[model samples]
Target: MARINVSQLKQACVDRGWLDRWLDDPATPVPMPMTPAGGIPVNGRLFHQLVAGLVQKLCVPDASAPLLALRSREQIWALLWDELAAAKVQALVRSQSAEAALHLAEALKAWCQRLAELRANCPNFKSWRSALLTHEFDLKRVAIQVSDGGVVEVSGRPDSVQVDPVHGIVVVDYKLSRGSNGTLDLLQLAIYARMLRLAKPGLNFAGLLEYYEPGLHLVPKTEAQLNAIFEHEVQPVLDRIAGHEKLMSKLKSVQVGHEAVRLSWQPKAEPDLGRDIEKAYNSFKVPVQVMGRVEAPQLVRYLIRPGLGISFAKLRSNAVNLKIQLGLHAEPLVMPGSGHVIFDVVKEKPDTVWWQDEVQRAELTAHASPLALALGVDINNRLILADLCDSNTAHALIGGSSGSGKSELLKSLVATLVKRNRPETLQLTLIDPKLLTFGGIVENAYLTGPILRDIEESLACLHLAVEDMERRYEILLAENHTRLGDRIAQGKTDLPFRVIIFDEFADLINSGREEKKEFERLTKRLSAKGRAAGVHLIIATQRPDKDVVTGQLKANLPMKICLRVTNAVNSQILLDEPGAEHLLGRGDFLSQTGSTPVRGQSLFIPQKEFLELFADKI
Candidate 1:
């Protein structure tokens, strides 16, 4: 195999956009822009400039240098390792002729295999060793950011976001290190939190800086901290640029200093093994138990790492025919109750636990109509169950991917309600932002108003519903009634509730705080007091983020309808958790009112069925 090429490494850097925003000066052997800043550059000043350039490009607009100073020890080491590894790989690939370069790749591949073996055999050192003499913290590297010159823009990504459902907004930065540097890190957190609020809608943001290593420190965002970062950290960096230009001009320095820029490399030093293991943690932090099922621990280490990406090509090849196998997939009889089969394939042992399967084989088929189960209006009208509505409340959540029959389910429910309840005793208020889900329900002649859409209109609908609720509350107070049920029992005239339904709630919240605040207020009010006022809400969405429908909203809507959510996580988010993800689409749903969920496919009424059903009326 041929030796690696230095020129080609530089070419790789250029092609990959790695050198795009660097602060490299040829006159200085070491580039100041490439080196990490310690307030002012030390060591290789020229290399420091390149590092500064990287910060400028990656940092969010209006970032404070001081606040951006604290980087996680693990991230810092990983960044450096990636840089070194990339340089090594590119050099090896471009050596000699094209054929020779291919041969060199083979050798490099073998070297990585050896490294993998060494890694596997190494003993793991826990970050925390003992109580008194803890060994968790490691000081890795410092992170800095700089402007990405052009039209000013917000530039940065939050690694993770922790939402404070109770107190508006707070941005938390998880870091390592403490004392004076920790103070600087808090300032950085302040700058980021402020920028985040300015960039998005909602309440002004707060900040939290948490350091995991050494000891814990809680840094709350304060105006003074941000000011310190701006005045001390940001201003000094700007001054450096001018200082460098003036000094360079006076000295007439036309060439970079190679010796001045060279890295502090010990001639025969081995790698820093501790930092390497932490850096090898490629996946998100997961508990050891769940880690086995969701992304096996071995896969994360060997399959996805940048250094080991090429090793995966041989993984599938290692799975050739085996003698004896473990687990259900390897069973001789391809069924759950086949029992243990010998490797000889001639003898089988009876597994008596299989009898339990036979008993439940057909009993657990989820055999019931969703509507019949939801309203407790079984075939004979016997009270097989009691619904949330019957217990003097109504609430629901509907989720479906586009064309997954979410709207169809809504229409069917409305039709069922019309058939079961009276127009005079029950009123429906439909809010369809898309203006199509309630197309079939418009002719029912029981709707309180036209479909609620525009923000102002939706808010007004909420206001009107609140007014109706308050009026009922006043009437109840006058009669000394505890609930609408009590008032109706006393022969009240306006005892019918105003059932308000919101469709495409995700889009409504998409406008931000204005709508979200209104919804939050309306939800809190209705959840706490609307049941007495005969005002209940049924909201539906296509997405299942906790931020949208919200945890508070989901909690109040105990009687929920989950229609083919993308996954089990979402199903769990809406309900307790699991069954929704497994829901067969097209109106197949899981409705939970009290405890156990009822799973069944709703009747699919075609257009002809609806047309014939309403043939005499519409």
Candidate 2:
């Protein structure tokens, strides 16, 4: 079925011809050329990314200095320009041509200058900062499925959402265009306001279009106007698109047994995968026979028995060549053994490992380990369990890029942890700097305390954990117990296994050098000695860089769980390898117990279901 973007809806509202043209030639690009900056044409996408990053950073400043009103123009601009040097943003800027960087830098300055002018005319920066909620937020949170055809996601991020004293909730969209008279601009703002209203009902939303001009042009649309826009303008377009998509689907559907048929499951394996593998090996002068393949949720493992006289090293060296020859998106995992070479290929339609099903079938016995976590299912569809009590799996370092299912994996891990053990046997310390991931299960009985949100609170939580660890050690020493597990095994249920799951660990470290140092010190001490004291750290970050996941931290965290990363370098930072870069996002993961990395699909539970599951304390 065809997906409809909010932008398309906006264009359709303005002129249905635009939507028809887009549907006819979806691949056609719009003809608006970005203005030249620094002798180079500005990349619209990159410019938006830079602006979005700055807006988000500005809106959600550090908790220590939450007031944007206090900062001078110099400080604000410094923050905006300094953000370019950030690892994630820097990667984006560096990937382009050197001239692209100059273009973005100049474009950013121009954009920020306009922004400053708008802010300067505002009545109160303090009020504005206080009213600000979020920026560059994902619109998928409020995506609505259109007649089972496709999900309609508001494709663009709304500039800002602020609660006004008199105007109520204002959904703000900043415009760089010379005029806000354009139909699409007004519709875009109206659609975003509608999305926010849908996501959070009962909140009155007003669409405010702010243009980048010398004078303030805060055009506010009332709730009645918003409703009119959605019902009169947006709803009609959506209905037409739905009808069109249905027709398209009917035209595409295959008939079988007097009914249009839909396949229950489609295999992701390339029809000529085995043949391609053989062809690749043959090209490298090492002919191999396809033995068989083991199909799993996320990937397929191909068993290739090479012909005699083909050395394992020779075959290993041609891994890259195999990837190229096979036309693979990522470098396929090629393991050349004594007799057979294993080729693991990712699938197009990766299966989901549902949370309830996995937990119901999981082997959660007290005799196994004090902190047994059902990580995910391996290639053989077998439940892969890791005992935090074991030295090799004591601590874990999880890394991934955005939309890589890193957050979902964390939630699954949390659910598994809580489900596997009783509240007395396990306690959780969840620190989410973004204040998003662990909110659903904040009231879970297994939580040691409330979910830590800010850096100060998180640092304090870690400090307290360290102190508690020392006290536990003292108790262990007095009782002549080597480890907490031994004590717990002896029916000492009072000593629960404390698991400190820190999500967005990069945010805390990246806040400042002092904060980073303190975090490192606390985590280092906990990771090194926390195991014996029944304390374990599971630190996760989207930005897996050397600065965030340092060498010392990596050494302590032997068990690495890596999801899809942006590059080989990021994958290497987490797993000391490059395979993670090729992973299919949304729960496709590689878990390294010690040195051997096992690929698996993580169990997923949607936010609503997760919240319901842990709604009443456990």
Q: Which ten residues in a row have the lowest lDDT in candidate 1?
A: 290-299
Query: What would the TM-score be for candidate 2 when compared with the true structure?
Result: 0.54
Off by over 4 Å in 2: 1-272, 306-331, 336-339, 362-367
Alpha carbon lDDT at 140, candidate 2: 64
Residue pairs with colliding backbones in model 2 are: none
Candidate 1 local lDDT, 293-378, one digit each (tens):
11110011111221333232222221121112211122121101011110111012111111112112211112111112222111
Native-vs-model 2 lDDT? 0.72
Best-matching candidate per TM-score: 2
TM-score for each model: 0.38, 0.54
Error in Å for residue 83 of model 1: 74
